[model samples]
Target: MAALTCRQVGNDFFKEGRWREAIDKYTDAINLDPNDHLSYTNRATTYSKMKNYTAAIRDCKKSIEIEPKHIKAYYRLANSLKMLHCYDESLVTFNTFLGFEPNNNLAQNERTQVKTAIFKEKLQGAQVHPALRILSWANCDNDPLSCKARLLAATLEFNKGNEDGKNRNVKGLIEITEGIMLDERCFIIPSSINLAVNTAFEQNKALSPTLSVRATILKYKQRLAQDGWDSVLPALATNIRAAFLIGYMSRFTPDVRNIDQGIENIRRAIELASFATEIAPVATDDINSIDPILKITFLRTLKVHLMEAILIKYKRNIEMIDLFDKVLQLAKEVIESCNENPISTEDTISYCAYYRGHLEEAYGAIGSAYNERSKFSRGELGFQERDLKLLLESVKNYEKANEYFPSDDPKFALFHYLTASYKLMIGGCTLHEIKQHAQKAKECEKEAYPVFGNYLGDIFEKSMVFQALEQLKRPNNIASDDKYFLPQACHVSSNSEEEEQRFIREYEARTGGTIAATMDLSQAAARANAEFLRNGISIISSDKQ
Candidate 1:
C-alpha cells in the first residue's frame, strides 16, 4: 500500500513536469518495494523526461528483470536506446516487443523508424563509388538494405558500362545478375520482420550466403527471368529507382533481344511514378509531408518514357500514327504536371535547375517525335496537309524547348539548330522566311563552333546539311523549288553515326570521374528530414536551410 501511494505521488509529479520531484517520489516507491516493476518503469519514464536516457535505460532493464513480461519496460528501453542513437540495439528491442504484441501499430512504426535509421547510417558510412559501395553491401546477408543496395548498384554499373567504347570493364552484367538474386531475397522480408531479424542473427538462414556467387546468380536466373515490382519490397521510392534504372539501361543497350524487356520496364516505372505523384501531398502549408524524392523520380520517369518512344520511332516497331499519339499524350501529361508543380521558394536552386532541364528535354522530345511522324507521313496520299501541320507544331515545340533551356548552356546551341531545322522544313515558306531561319542557324553554328570545333571538327565539316544551311544564308543561292533543301534540313535534326560517336567522346571527356564521385544529395536531405521527424520535431518549422 505504501509503495502504491509513492507511485501515485510520482505519477502526479511527472504529470506536473516536476522532474526532480518525480524522481524522488519514484525512488521512495522503489525503497518501499524493491521488486515493484511498475515503480522502476515509472522512474525510468521520469528519467527519460529529464533527458537522462542512460538512467532511464538502467531502470528499464531492472524493471524487465523483475517482471520479464512487463511490456512497457521493453518500449521504454527501446525508446531510450533510440534517443541515445543506439539504433541496432533499439531495433532488436523493438523486434522483441513486436514478438509479444504483433498488432501494435505504435511499436511497428517505431521499429520501421529504427530500420530507417540503420539504413541511413549504413548509406552514409558506405560512401564510395556508388556501384562498388552497393556491390559491397550485396556481398552481405539478404537484409532489406543489402537487397536495395544491390539493385541500386547494379543500375549504376549498367549505366557506366552501356556504352561499348567506354567503361566496358565495369562488369555491369555481373552486378545485375547479383541484383536479381537479391531481389528474390527481398521477397522474404515483407512476410515478417522476424524473418529479417532471424537472417540478421543467424547467417545460415539466408539462401544467398550459403550458395557460391556464380551458383546463386545462375539459380535466380533459371528460377525467374524477371521479378515483377509486386514481388519486391513495397517501397515506392526504391521501386521507382529500380524500374527507371533497369528500363533506361536495357533500352539503350545495342542488344536486339533486350528491347521489348526494356520497354516493359520503362512502362512499369512510368506507372509507379505517376501513381506516386497522384498521391503526393499537395497542401503547401504542410511542407513536411512533401517528399522531394518523389518529384525527382516522376521527372526521371517521364524522361525515360520519352526516350523509349523515340527508340520505338527509330526502330519502327510501332506504326507512325501510334507513335505520334503516344508521344503527344505523354507531352500533354508532362506539361500539365509541370504547370501544377511550379517552382517555389522552398525548392533549392539546384532542384529548380534540374526541374527546368527535364521540362526542356520533354518539349524537345515532343518536337522530335512530331518531326519523325511528319517525315513518315510525307508520301502517303491525302496526308500532305497533316504532314505540314505536324512540321509547324514541331517548330512551335522546339521554340518552347529553347525558351526553357538555359541560354548560356552549350546544349542551347543544339536546341537552336533543331528549331531552325523544323522552321525550314515548313512548306511554302518564302525566301525571307528561309533567310531568317538560316541566319539564326548560322549564329548558333558560329557560337558553338569554338566550343565543339576541336572535338567535332571532322563531322561538322563533312556534314552536307550544314553546307545547305550556309548556302541558304545567301539570297542569291535560294532555289525556286525549296523542296531540295527539305531532305538536308531533316538530316540536321537527327545525329549521324559519326556525330553521335563524337558527342559521346566529348561528353565522356567533359564529365570524367565526376559521375562516379557524385552521390544523390537529395536523398541525404530527405534522410535528414526523416531524422528530424524521428526526434519529434516538425521539419518545416526547423528550417535551418
Candidate 2:
C-alpha cells in the first residue's frame, strides 16, 4: 500500500511535467517494493520523457523480465531502441509487441518506417545494377496489387527504363513504356471523369498512350485538389511516386514535348511533397518536426529529380535560369537543415553521413549550374564582371563539394576534372595559376583514365587539351619569350595533315614534354573545339554521374 501510494504520487508529478521529482518518487516506490513491475514501467516512461533512452530501455527490460506478458514494456522497449537507432533490436521488439497486439495502427506504421530505413541502408553503397536488383526484391511483396506495392513496382520499371534509355535500347524502352502504362492503370480513379481536363485535351480525343496516362494523372490531381490530401492519404505514396517517375522517365528521349511533360510532372511532385510536409502534424521539437525519415526521404528524392530536370533543360538549351535559381534555393535549405544539430545518437550519425553525401552532390550540381551560367553570360555585352564572378562562384562550390565528397569515390576524379576546367576559364588567371590548374587536370585524367578508359576518359583528356591550347594561343595574355606562349592559334585548315602535325608539336612544347604518351591531340582538339562551339559549354551531365 505504501509503494502504491508512492507510485500514485510519482504519476501526479509526471502529469505536472516534473520529470526529476517523478523519477525520485518512482525510485521510492521501487525501493519499497523492489520487484513491482508498474513502478519500473512508470519510471521507464519518465526516463523516456527526459530523453534518457538508455535508462528507459533498462527499466523496460526489467519490467518485461518481471512480467513476460507486459505489452507496454515491449512497446516502450522498442521505441527506446528505435530512438537510439538500434534498428535490428527495435524491429525484434516491435514484432514481439505486434504478436501481443497485432492490429495496432501506430505499431504497424512504425514497423513500416523501420522497414523503409532498413531498405535505405541496404541501398547505401549499391551501384545502379545492384540497386535495381534490390528494388526488384522490394517489389516482390505478396500483396503486389496494393497501392504502396504498385509504387515500388513503378519505381523499378522507371529505373529500368532510364537505364535502357541511356543504352539506346529501343525494344527495352518500348517494353518499359508498356510496363509503366500498366502501372498507371492502378492509379486511375474509378469515377466517371472524362479524359479532358480542358478543351486542349478534349480536342485530342484519340489520345496516344502517353496522353491517356497524362489524362489519368490529371483526374487524380483534380481529385486531390477538390478533396483535401487527407481524403487520399492512403494512396498518397502511389500518387507521388507515379507523378515523379513519369516526369523523370520523359528525359529518355530528346523530344521537346516529352521534356516539357517531364518538367511539369516533376514540378507537381515537388509541390505535393511540400504540401505533405505542411499538412503533417508536428511530431517532435527537433529539426525533423514531421515524420523525419520518411518525409525527408520524399522531399530529398523529389528535389534531386527536380535538379535532374534542370540539367535536362539546360542540355537542350532551353532558358532555365529560373529553374537553376529554384534548385539553388532548395539545396541551400537542405544544406542549412543538415547543418543544424550536432550528432548525438547512432540515428543522428547515420543521418549525417547519408545527408552529407547528398549535400556533396547538391554542391556539385550548384557548381555546374554556376559554370553554365557563366558561359551563357559571356554571350551578352557588359556582363564580363558577372561572368567572372559566376566562374569564381563555380570554383568555390566545386571546392566545397570536394571537401564533402570521399576522396576515394570514383566520382571524385570527375569533380576534380571539372574544377580544373573551370579554374582555367577564370578571366585574368595568372600564368602560375594556369600551370597549377593544367597540372591538376592532367593528374585527374590520369587517375580516371583506367576506370573510364573507353569513352569518358577520352572526352576529358581532349577537352583539357583544347582548353590548354586556347589559353596558350591568347596572344596578349603571356609574353612571347615564354615557352608556353604561342604567336598564333592552332587553327585546323584544308591541309589537315600538316596542321595536325603542327598542333601536336605546339601542344608538346607548351606542356614541356608532360603530355600523355598515347595522346593524338589533333583529332581530339578538333572534336573538342567543335563540341565546345556547338554547346557553348560542356555542362556536367547529372545522369551520367
Candidate 3:
C-alpha cells in the first residue's frame, strides 16, 4: 500500500513539475512492485530527463508489455527510441499510440509526419531505376481490362504479314492506337512520330521465326512475286521492317541508320507492288481485282514512297517530286465496287478517310520535296505548298464524286489543300484553309518529322518554323522548343522589315532572343498546357497550346 501510494505521488509530482521529488517517489514505487507498469513508466520518464536514454527505453518497453493501453508509456517509448536513433522503431510506437486513441490530435499528427518521411524515402529510391517511373492519376470510362486485352490481341495480329494477315492487323492496330491515344497511359507511353521512327528499322513478318512459319511467309511472298520477280522479295522485306520498327520502341531518339534502313525498306515495298501495276502497261487490266489486302497495302506503300525517296537520294532529291504522284484511283475503284458490288468490298469509310489522308500526306511530301530541292539550289520556291487553283479545276475531274458531298468530305479535304496550294502556286490560293491546310499538312508530317525532322518538306519545315515562333512567344522557360520539329521556324524573318520589328518586340518581353535568357524560366501558364507536345509545334492550332 505504501509503495502504491508512492507511485501515485510520483505521478502527482511529475505532473506538478517537481522532478527530484518525482524521481525519488518513482524509484521507491519501482522497488515495491517491480513488474507494475505505472511504476516503470514513471521511473523511465525520470531517467529520460536524466539523459539515460538506453535505460529509459528498456524500462519503457517493460511498462508497455505489462500495460499495453498505457498511452503515457507509449509516448515515453517513442521518445526513448528516437533518442537511441531508432527512428523507424519510434515511428512504430507512434503508430501504436494512434491505434489506441484514434481521436488524439497529437498522435495523429505524429503518425502523418512519420508516414510522409517513409514515402519520401521510397520516392528517393525510385530515382535510380533506368526507365523512368512516371505516375499519373485517372479513371477509365469503360473497361480498362478490355482495352488492354484488345491491344494484346492487336500485337499478336501484327506478327502475321501476308497481305491478308497484314490487313487483319490494320483494324486492330487502328483500334489499339486510337484507344491508346485516348488513354492517359498511351500518350504517357508516346504516340505517332516516335512509333513510326522506331518501326522504321524493325522486321515485321514474325515475332520469333518458327521454321515452319518462316517457310510459309517466304512461300507467300514468292507466290505474290511469281518466282521470277526481283522486286517482290525486297518490297516484302521493307514492309516487314517498317511494321516492326514503327510498332515498337517509341519515345527514344532514333539513329540515322534506322532512318536510312527504313527509307530503303519502304522503297522496296513500293517497287515490288509497282511490278503488279506495270505488268499490263496498256491500262487494259482492272487493278481493283487485285487482292483487297494487296490493293490497300500497295496504295498505302506508294503514298509513303515519296517520304522514303526523299531521305535517301540526298543530292538528286529533286527527283522525289516527279517520282511521286497520287491516285485515289485505287480507293475510288474500291468505293465504287463496294457500292456496286456489296459482297466484294470490306472497305470502311475509315479506310477511305485513311487513304484520303494518305493522298494529302503524299501531296504534302511532294510539295515539301520540291520546296526542299528548290531551297537547296538556293534560289526561289518553285511550287506553293497549298493550291486552291488546281483543286477548283480538279473538282470537274471529281464530277461523279457525290453531288451533295459536304465540302468537309475526305475528297474535299484533299481538294481543299490541293486547290489552296494550286492557287498559292499560281499566286492565287486565297482561303485561310490554305494556311490551315498547311497546318494540317504538318499534322500529316507527324510521322515523318521524328525520322526526317524539318528536312522532309518546305511547307513542313515552314509549319515547324511557325511553331517555333509561337514557342518563342510562350511565357516561360519550362516549355522546351524542339528545333527539329519546325527547324525552319528557328530564325524566320520575312524580307519584310516591319513585321520583323513587331515580332522582335514581343519575343523580347518574354524570351529575350537567346537560349540562355529563355531556358531559365518556365513557359507561360497559357502555353504550358499538360497536353502540348514538345516534339513539334502545330502553329495552326484552332486554339493556343
Candidate 4:
C-alpha cells in the first residue's frame, strides 16, 4: 500500500531525528489515505516536536474527527495547543485523555499545570490598596501608610492563593513583606521573598512591565540558590520565575501572557505537591495551601499532550521520574470529575495517592471514606453515589492494578486496595477474610512486580502497561486525619427538603435505641429482683427443714 510506504518513511524519519522530514512524510501518508488515523496522528506528533503548533493541532484534530478514539491525536493536539498557550483548548484535550485512561498521571499533572495558568490570568486585574495587598485596601483610606501598604498588600496576596483578592485580611500583605524583609537571607523561604519582591515591584503600575519582570527575575535568580534540597530547587525557581512573569507581564500582555504564566504556575504547584509528599512533617502550623493555584489549561487535548510528555519524553529521561510523580499528584487533584454526594473525596485522594506510591496514606484516606459512607444522608448522595458500584469496581481495578503495581513504584495500588478492604469491612463484608486478602495483596505486590518502566500511559505506550506485578505487605498505621481536601459543602449543592427528612431519620436512629433501652430498664429490673427474692426464701426454708 502506498499509505504503508509513506507511513514507514515517516516513522523512519521520526526515528532518524529528521522531524521536519517526518512531518512531511506523515502529511504525504495522510494524503494517500485520508482515512488513516495513524497518518494524521503521526504528522501531528511530528508537528509538536517541530513546535509547529498550528499544523500539529490541525492534523491531530483531523485524526480525531475521523476516529473519535484517536487518543494519540488528542494528546498531540493538546501539546501543540499548550506550546501555543491555548490552555482552555488544551484542557479539553487532556480531559479526553483522562476519559480513556483515568489512571494516567501525566494527564492529571498537565491538567493542574494548565489550571494554574488559567488562574494567573484572572489574577491580573487585582485591586490594590494598603489593606488589600492583592486587591485595593479599602479601610486604610485615612492612614498615611495607605499607599505603600496597599502595594505591599497586593504582592502578599498574590503570593497566597488569591487569584484576585489581595491582603485585605490582617495577615495583610505587609506582614509577608515584613517576614521577608526582617531576614534578607531568609534561606527558609527564597520563593516567598522572591514572590513578595516581584509582586511589589510589578504592582508599581508606574513601571514598564517587561523591564520590571526582567529585573525581578534577575534578583530572584541570585537569591534562589539559597533554598535547600538538591533536585527540587531549580523547579522552584522556575515556578517563582513564572509568578514574576505573570504579574509583570499582566500590564502589557493582558490575558495572553497571564495564561502562559498560569500554565507555568500550575506546573509549579504540582512540583510543590510532589515536594510536600516526600518531605518530613514540620511541626509548625502551615495553614497555607501551595502557592499560585493556577488554573489548568485543561482541555481533553492538552491532557493527552502532557501525558505523552511523561510517558514518551520521560522514558528517555529517567531523571524526570520525580517530575512525573508531581504530574501524577496534580492530575489526581483535578481530574476525578466525580459528581458530589456519596462519591467520597477520601476515595478520590486515596486513588491519587495510590498512583503516587503513598500507599499508607491512600489506605487511610479510603478507609476514612468507607467508614463515613454510612454518614451521608440518602438524599445527599448526589450522582457520585453511583460511584459506590464504581468504587467496588475500583476495588477490583486496584486488586488487578496492584497485581502489577510496584511496591516502590509510585502507583500506590496496595494502599488503594487496603483502603477498599477497610471500606468493605466496615460495610459488613467479610472483615477477617478481607484482612487476609488485604495482607496477601501487599505480600504478593512487594514480592513480585518489576519497576523498570516509566509512569503509566495507556494510549500510545500500551506495551509498558501493567509493569509492576506486586508489592510487599505493610500495616496501615498512619492515623487517619479524615480531613477533606475538597470542601464537604461541595458534596451537597444545598440540603433540600429530602435531605432534611433523611437528616431526621438519622437523628432518630441515634436517639431511639437509647430511649428504648432506658424505658425497659426499670420494669425489667423489678421482675428480676422479685424472682431472686422468692428463690432465696425457698432455698432458706429447705435448708432449715
State every prediction's TM-score relative to the real structure: 0.40, 0.43, 0.28, 0.25
In model 1, which regions exceed 4 Å deviation?
Answer: 1-234, 274-289, 296-320, 344-346, 349-355, 377-386, 427-465, 472-545
lDDT of 1: 0.52
Local accuracy of candidate 1 as per-residue lDDT tens digits, 1-545: 99999999999989999989989999998998999999999999988887666678889999999999999999999998776556777888998898899999998998998799778766766332223222222111122222233233234323323321133322332233223222211111122222222322232222232344345335433433355322221234444444544554565466656766666656655665555565444536544444433454345534435464454644454354766676667766666666766653245422322345456767877777776666543354423323668767777887788776554333455555555444444433322343354455556545433223322233421232243333222122233332323233223324343543343344345556343133121222223322332333332321111
Candidate closer to the true structure by TM-score (higher is better), 1 or 3: 1
Writing each residue's lDDT as its tens digit, candidate 3 over 1-545 gives 87899998998998887878998898898788776788888888987886555567777888978887788999888766554434567788887876777788877776666566556645755342211111110111112223222222222222211222234433333333332222212222324333432232232332222223345355645655574434343334334433323422221225545555545444443444454444422432554544322444434533344343443343344344433222223334434434443331134322222333333333344333333443322126332232334333443333323232223233333433343333333332122323455455445445223212232344433433344333433323343543211222213332233443454455556555554234211122113321233323333332322
Q: Which portions of model 4 miss their true places by more than 4 Å?
A: 125-545
Error of 1 at 502 (Å): 43
CA lDDT, candidate 3, residue 392 = 39
Backbone clashes in model 1: 0
Which pairs of residues clash in candidate 2, taking residues 3 or more apart in a chain or in different chains? none
Report the lDDT tens digits of candidate 4 across residue range 379-405. 552321223453453354345434333
Candidate 4 TM-score over all chains jointly: 0.25
Give the local distance difference test score of model 3. 0.43
Winner by lDDT between candidate 4 and candidate 2: 2
Worst 10 residues of 1 by lDDT: 181-190
lDDT-based ranking: 2, 1, 3, 4
CA shift at 486, candidate 4, in angstroms?
62
* Candidate 3, superposed: residue stretches over 4 Å from native: 1-257, 270-292, 296-299, 302-346, 349-354, 376-545
